[model samples]
Target chain A: MTSIAVPPSAPEHTGSRLTRVLGAATAVSWVVWLTYGLVLSPADVVQSESVRLFYLHVPLALSAYLGFTVTLVGSILVLRKNSAFWDQMAGAGAEVGLVLAGLVLVTGALWGRPTWGTYWVWDPRITATTLLFLVYLGYLVVRRLDLDAEVRARRAAVFGIVAFINVPITRYSVQIWNSLHQEATLSLTDTEMDGSQLTSFALGAIAMALFTTWLIIHRFRVGWLEYELDRSGLESAILERRGERTATEVV
Target chain B: MIAAVAGDAARIVAKDLRIERATGVITTQILPFGIVMLLLFGFGVDPALQVRGGDRSVLAEVAPGLFWITVLLALLLVVGRAFAVESDDGSLDALLVAGVHPAAILGGKAVVVAAELVVLELVVGAGAVLMFDVTIGDPLHLVVVMVSTTVALAGAGTLFLAVVAGQRGRDTLGPLLVLPAMAPVLIGATAAAGDALYGAGSGGIAWTWALVAFALLYSVAGIVGAGALLEDV
Candidate 1:
């Protein structure tokens, strides 16, 4: 159990309160969603049982994007304000985003295998999504660099900003190149969703967003504690050496 | 301010050029490595087989993609060599403390690498044309695509190299970070160059414009973001 030292400037109440609230809320939401998704929702006319995968796949994809967006925001804050809060947020958001993005890839492939008759396709959407995943994986690599804390934070922040800026470019270029996937089934302009499907989807997305937030907060605290622990260890080691020298002199 | 930056950048470029010239790494190392890559690809593909298979010219069709792929691979070596020159004997520290803006350092480095890439492009492009039998129907368009792609690659390559500079295994990590990001550049440049070489108006001209956008985006981002990165040290 690593303990976080609350700095004078930090908020007194941060990790535990929010963590418990979010954890409970996410659990409840997941239960509601599972009931709605599995037991209540009607099967699709064409795809039947496989369509339920949609609830998981789409919300996970959206949550991954949300996670990265938070990273982008935190990265901007890090550069603008030189805030450690933002740095922790960016690092944690990136880790969470990377995991969710990976899950999106896995779930997407599983969904595709059943629906599209193959596990992988070079559809433009798939290509862009994979590129997004790779870009953030690179972000994680940057974060893992063995450097001073400040230097690492600054470098990762800049990388995060640059990577986020490239997302639209990647999406546009892939679209221009070509797409083989079926036309988008969900959108504001072209598609309409009925009551139960919309309700279930909204519930799932909310749960996912809450879950992402909860994980980021806990991870940020862990990072802060790690830094504090390292500094205290260094301080105590120096104190021990000084004490040893003083006792030798007394002798 | 701009003039001061330009002057400082010019000095850095001159210093780098002098060092590289003395070493002849550009001529002796990167150039040969690029040429060998071309030869290996040519021999492995064996355009002769395509010709026998009744294709008009498989090498010609593949020429643009092969050219960019070769350039992309050679780019990794060029970036590695450039940073290797900087990371020796506290030179990087000296530059950081020189009171010059970090963007100038970035500009200088990008110019140096971009110039090297141009030279590499000329030599390797000539080699590719000869062996791959690539015909340029529109040299002007080809030049545009090449220039834009070069700019994009230089900007992004320099930025990423700087980002990974402090890492231990940066030699390997730099390429891992850069290659995927360069995918759009690769796709757009290859497509536009294909149209230029083959005279195929297969809507690839649009990709050339995308290349231009990519170049500007990368260069501007590198310029704006590099100062903070350099300050991190």
Candidate 2:
């Protein structure tokens, strides 16, 4: 919030006017979509009002996958090209993806209470999503180790890319198992959803994705600055230590 | 580069096998914990030994599940050990500098983990069947379930191991990391064994076989992908 901290003329990507515009667009779209979904979207015939969960669950799940995909792609860059920028992207994306996955889990549980009459079931999709969340959490936590930057980044990058096993697992687990969860929105040889409901789902997913990409970019920039600060601090500390040793000898 | 990589791979695997053979120590660290878990499940949960109302069938159905739970936890135990072993001995850095393929490192570690799991599951499975009065209708489904689950678990676990090998808290974080990813194996094996114990009746083999294949496919995909992506890691 401080102009000094941001340093308007200090050779930094202080985010263009375009970013600000997109940010506002994202907020407006979210409000419109959430309100339309909550009040206007027609309820499912079988589950009545509870089916309104499709909005929260599907969008959140899609966003989580999108975020994780970014993490995966960023990690691939970290390993293939040894780019720290990609590492920062992976770290931030994992944390954000984990958050979205958590929302998906909570909303799914809430919906489960009405439809399945239980707060929890070992349903395939739910279980797989939970697993995916844990994997991302592991990736995030493991990166916190005090190791060389490349070492930490490369290790976590491998993890982000490898943990992608859960993507398909989450998408297909319900279909694979005798799950209590409903089938996917898009299925092979079958149409699972239609009309304004699908339209709403599509719009909400796009909005969430734009919002997610924006968050990831902002987070990556913050990480870059933080790394810069840390490197300078380390340099100063080392120089101060050398100065003190020389002073002691002079005394 | 490929041939050189293959040569190093062969050498590393050979060294690992010789070291393992000499020490005869593959996952001994997790053995104590695995034993405790099996005992707790047996004495605490199934102590009554009540076979009434087809509970025997249920226990038999759950037999394969016990091994998976054991495998997941035990794999968690050895993750820190696997990575810590390499780092403590400075072998990981040496290997990295030696131009050895990262896949070779993963494959070597995976072979050892697979061996440990196979041995661990055997002991644990025998103990469960003996203690719980469990039965099996077909030995082949049991084999498929065990092999597939073990492969899937070790593949997934070792992938995490490579990622977290340099970090702290790997000891506690390993199991936590392994479980959610291991869901398909748990459910698939449970369903397979449960169906077999309940009579292999109606939709049993088909569904169980399908899940096993799915687990295998995922595991192979995960292992190959991890091996490829973990190069600079």
Candidate 3:
């Protein structure tokens, strides 16, 4: 289960209970999403069975947005407190967010192909989403720069905050530009969804949200463990080098 | 404190300007690059074909977009060069420890960039008129659009410079990072300029106002966040 090397003595029980519960919840949520996509919701009117893509697509898009938002919050805290935990959280969130964002773009294109008769358009939402994806991908690239962990975290934090600042502007600009894409059917003010479709959508959204949270938690934990192991290994190596020098001098 | 910071910033700007003047880098290097880009754009638009038909409307329509895109490219070059200059000869470390406020450093660099962009626009604007036979519907509106867009690019470019200066392959990565973020500004500026050139009334003024807002937003972000970006780098 450990993708990263972890010390055997590292406390595994501190959050074990929460992890187990979340694991079960994640499993349940995936089931719910699949069931809703396959059986629960009726086919859409204009889109027909292709509207099932909506069940998968919207939740993933929302999850990607939620992940980036979490990264933004973590970055803000990282800057404020300079905490390693916040750094790890931000990195994990961005990594997962990037993957989900790519999926969002792919799913969007797939959905567009059937609905709009083309796989691509310079529609504002698509443009903005593309920009969002690029910006965070740049964020992850910044994190990979060859610097000390502390320095890297600080740099990535600054970028993280800056990138988030662009999100709203990107969204607003795209919305401001005339879009060929259809107007949103689901929103706070009004929703076209009704009866069983609405219920299934709600379930899909909740399940996706839960699944997203579980992924982030697991990613962050793995990252924390990796760093901890690195530090310990570095300390032991330094001590062994000192011992070797003393032994050579005595001989 | 403000005066002291302003004084330091002025010194940095003066130093940078003096270097540009002595080296003639702006006139010799950037000017040639801008002209070449204008030539390529003119060829791409193929204004010669339109002129033979006695209809210059298509040329006029594409003129603003072509102009702003050229400026965006020029802005990217200048921003990359400005930071690259600091990284050369280990001056970035020197500048950091020189006891100057980091915001002042950003302010100094931004003003220099804004100045350079003014010259770039003049050259690009002249080329567009001569090559495309473009007409300006509202010179005043165009000036407003140009100034605000220049300032917006300056502020945001400085911030992005700081973000990528220390990274490897910064030359390529810097543009990659800045261009996507600058997408909105590009859209707004192009729309406003297009509106000013062809007298497209709808949403033109609004887009111009958005450019002004962008200028303010980027300047504030750069000024406020410069210290954090420079810290421990």
Candidate 4:
């Protein structure tokens, strides 16, 4: 289990009762979501069967937004406090957000093909989302740079703050240009859902949110362990060198 | 405090301009690269091709976007060079140690870059007009869009340059860091320039305002954030 040099005090794995329970809830919710969303929900009047992708697509998009929000918040806190925990949180959120955003694009494209008669269009939302993805990808790239951990954290934090500020500007700019995307089906002041579709969507959202949380928790643990391993590795290397010198002196 | 920052910024700007004048890298290398890119774009667009339903050639129609794209590509190089000089000689560290505020350093560099980009735009805009036979219907609109876009690009580019200043593989990483952040500039500038050069409508004014807003947004971000960004660099 301890394939790398980790302190014995470190947790053996990135799981606990809470994650396991969340994992189980997520699995059950997904199962219910699939049964209802795929099999039971009536086909859309306009989209026909293709609308089924919404169950996954909308939830994934929301999760991606949530993940990035976490990143943005984490980044802010990191900058303010210079906390390692926030740095790790920022990193984990970006990774998960990137993955989910990728899926959101794919699903969106897939849904667009049959409904919009093309795989892609320069719709305002899609274009803005694509830019958002690229920005975060850049954020992750910065995080991966070979630098001191504190330096990297600071850089990433500054980037995260700036990138978040860019998001709304991007969205508004594209929106002002033109839009083929439909109005929001789910927003603070709106809900365009029927009973069955709403139920399935709510379930999917719960499932995805739980799953995203679980993944972030695990990812955060992994990042924490890596940090520990790096520090411990340096210490052990120094100790080994010191021991070798002492042995040679004795010899 | 504000006066001190402005004073330091002016000195840095003068220093950068002097270095630029002495070296002429922008005039010698970056300007030529922009023209060459314009030529390459002309070749790619094929001067013979015309828009399907319009009297104008395809090149004329796309000149605005192509012009801005060329500017953006050149911007990556300018930003990389701007920071490269600072990081190469440890001058950036020296500036910090000399008690120049980080915001002033960022502002000074951005001003030089913005000025250089203005020159690049004028030359490149002239090149596009001559090569593509494009006309400027609203010169005022065109100038507004260009200046705002340049300021925004320079501000964002300088901040992002500071982000990757001392990192390894910054050449590759710089574009990855800066370009996406500039997407709105690309969209707004292209659309606004298209309107300006084509007499499309009143929409050019709106887009210009958007560009101005973008400029203000990034300038504020650069001023407020450059200090924290460069703290550990």
> Candidate 3, which segments miss by more than 4 Å at Cα?
A1-8, A11-15, A170-174, A245-251, B46-56
C-alpha lDDT of candidate 4 relative to the true structure = 0.86
DockQ of each: 0.66, 0.47, 0.61, 0.68
True contacts kept of each: 0.57, 0.57, 0.47, 0.68
TM-score of chain A of 1: 0.85
lDDT of 4 by residue, A1-251 (tens): 22456777799899999999999998998898899999999998889999889889989988988888889999999888989899999999989989998998999999999989998998878887888899999999999988888888988888998888655653354336556877656656668887988888888899899999999989999999998888898888888889889999999
**lDDT (C-alpha, whole model) for all candidates:** 0.81, 0.72, 0.82, 0.86
TM-score of each: 0.90, 0.82, 0.93, 0.92
Model 1 misses residue B181 by how many Å?
1.6
TM-score of 4: 0.92
How displaced is residue B12 in candidate 2, in Å?
5.1
Indicate whether candidate 1 or candidate 3 has the larger lDDT: 3
TM-score-best of 1 and 4:
4
Residue-by-residue lDDT tens digits, candidate 2, B1-233: 66765566567657766766676655455566777787777655553444546546445555667766777778775555556667777778788777666767776666667777788887777777787676767777777767776776667777766665655665676665667666766766667766665565535576577656755664555445554435444
Q: Which digits, one per residue and each the tens of the lDDT, describe model 3 over residues A65-171?
A: 78888889998888789788999899889888888888988988999998998988888888888888998988888888777787778777877877886666544
Worst 10-residue lDDT window, candidate 2 chain A: A1-10
Interface RMSD of 3: 1.6
Best by lDDT: 4
lDDT measured at residue A59 in model 2 versus the true structure, 0 to 100: 83
Q: Which candidate, 1 or 3, has the higher TM-score?
A: 3
